[model samples]
Target: MTPPATPTSQGRPDKPALTVLYDGACPLCRREIGVYRRLDALAPGATVCYADISDAAVPVPPGATRDHLLARFHVQDRDGVLLSGAQAFLALWRHLPGWRWLALLGRVPGAVWVMERSYRLFLRVRPRLQRWAARLD
Candidate 1:
């Protein structure tokens, strides 16, 4: 299904609503991204795109290095704004069918702040989780 022509702040509709940048090499990340991919495929007129940042062939966004992007969860919005951490997840959840409620919850005052803090904690242990997931592969 074709995405609706939603205008960005600059009045452009050429860009997809989101472009998710992910580390394909990380088993944990790959599995999570797989879930999103399946959901996106099932959603009619889904406007989210995925970019495997681990792949050398994928072009990194301007002013961002591949390593920096791979180090965190990131999504580029329709206006080409790059969001990281919980903000990125919130943006993605808003688009996914079953996940929109969580996005709404995130909109509550201080909810995103808490989520971002928790995400920062997760980042600290992500390498260990990645190693464990790789072992299961």
Candidate 2:
């Protein structure tokens, strides 16, 4: 992952930047991450780094692989807590400027369940989505 331009604020280096681990091999995931990259660029200090796990240049944690990341999003917070799937998305939303409300909603009773189910449905159809995206490329 390329280091983003240096943060303008001189803060503690111990503050971990938001690390988003995504599937590089999936076209649909790539398109979504591209949008995130653009948004992060607009909000400079918003992200520490982003990694496409499918990239040979990117390092994966022990026992992790491209297929694992393709199944869901993974986010590692500043304190080194790892969140997956819907929980990961919620964590990310919490960090975004105005989307903190979505994060709160995600934690509401049954919200995580709904998001997880929806994510599963998306995964089920992702192969077809990838093919469709590829045709456009």
Candidate 3:
């Protein structure tokens, strides 16, 4: 069984539950991340780190290139396991408060598989969405 989450003196977790790699330059991505960040602020027990892969200063995981990270959603869990697409989103959702239900759904048999497929479809149109979102900025 997992132990209860505890915050460090700095009010951050001793080890982050997940580190999210995102394309900070993308307006759509920023809006989504902003919602997650606000939810994270409301629930402090679990620590979620957000890294802007679009920023050269942010570090990329070993075996992953900057372009690869920027192209998709990715997250590193507490155990150092790297997950992308639906898996990454699930890991992140499990850390948040209200979003935990969505993460729980991911545990259902084949749910992740279906979600992954949907995410892949989204990737095909992501560039178009990004362009549209950028225009709104």
Candidate 4:
């Protein structure tokens, strides 16, 4: 089964929408999503579905559990490809303006390796950052 469409502002029918499944409960995640949302809103012809996976009412991805969604960043590209972690972020940046250059750079031979490793390291320290963010809120 496929996910539903993300109706564009112009209502033009196209390929499947690029949807970013995010954890709204996490301050870090929310901040990043907020940036992407703003960028997408300003970019013409860009339509992204921002799903709050932390919401109890939101449906879980086809085969993924809610915990899996919270553990890592996930994105469903227009091709219906599911991407996670650094790749997911890279895919998303490709749709945003200025950031598209960085996304292109990610396709370099060694860039993805480094980016994935960095994402793993960030995951390890995410708990501490979340705590700090919570305190700041």
Candidate 5:
């Protein structure tokens, strides 16, 4: 499928919006997404959007199942490039004000590997955090 042509922040009408799918039920996820949403509002030209993957009815693109989304973070770039885990986070940071530097830094050698390892470590305790979040919410 041809990617729809869209205007970039530079006013070139060929960039696609960055679409991020995240777990709303996860407290940490909610907090971070909330911050990014607020940041997105400040820069309307950036065209970053989000979807809550925690909802069973949320429609994702073909080839991505609930299990797949639940397993890691997902970000579909303007070119329809799908990224997961640390890459997903980097995709998101690239659009948000004050985060572009970190995103750029992530592209450095071994940064992604370190982030992915950290992400995996976080996943190890995600369930417990989710339960705690449930009680707090």
Candidate 6:
């Protein structure tokens, strides 16, 4: 079945509310997006577009692949600007009221480096974590 159309603020159905392309196969990535989806649902006037790129129908951009997405979060803001990894997380955080402080953390000394490093470590262990999750399933 086809998905319902995403509604727009100005009554235009042609544009996406907010595009969040994610890696569906990775458990950690899925969990992270799950949080975003829940937050979006609670926020008023929030229009989120969620797409899992593991589907064959999803078209990946240049220099981007399933592996790349598996390594980092990807989000396209309302204006079509693309952000990945820590920047993407920051973008999403900025939308939530209480979590806006996390966006400020992005500018602190060594914070971006730490976030990037932690994300890299997560990417490195994700495959093994997926295997464990599959076993549990």
Which predicted model would earn the best lDDT?
1
Residue 11's lDDT in candidate 4:
85
Candidate 3 whole-model C-alpha lDDT, 0 to 1: 0.86
Give the Cα lDDT of each candidate: 0.88, 0.73, 0.86, 0.85, 0.81, 0.73
CA deviation > 4 Å runs, candidate 3: 1-7, 10-13
Query: In candidate 4, what are the lDDT values of residues 88-135, reduced to their tens digit?
Result: 999888888778898998878999999999999999999999999999
Clashes of each: 0, 0, 0, 0, 0, 0
Which is the winner by lDDT between candidate 2 and candidate 5?
5
Better of 1 and 6 by TM-score: 1
30 in model 6: Cα distance from truth in Å? Answer: 2.1
What's the candidate order when arranged by decreasing lDDT?
1, 3, 4, 5, 2, 6
Runs off by more than 4 Å, candidate 4: 1-4, 8-16
Q: List candidate 1 stretches off by more than 4 Å.
A: 1-13
- Which pairs, if any, clash in model 5? none
Q: Lowest-scoring 10 consecutive residues by lDDT in candidate 6?
A: 1-10
lDDT of 6 at 68: 71
Model 6 lDDT, full chain set: 0.73
State model 1's lDDT.
Answer: 0.88
| Better-scoring candidate (TM-score), 2 or 3 | 3
The residue pairs in collision within model 2 are: none
Candidate 5, 1-137: lDDT as tens digits: 12345656687867446887888878878987889999988995657777787888777767778778877888888777788999989888888898889999796999999999999999999898878877877
Query: How does each model score on TM-score?
Result: 0.88, 0.80, 0.88, 0.88, 0.83, 0.78
Whichever of 3 and 5 has more TM-score, that candidate is: 3
Across 1-137, the per-residue lDDT of candidate 6 in tens digits comes to 12235656677664444567888876666776788888887888766667787776876655666667646678776556768878888777887657779899998999988998898788788788888876764
lDDT tens per residue, model 2, 29-68? 8887787677666664566467777787776655566567
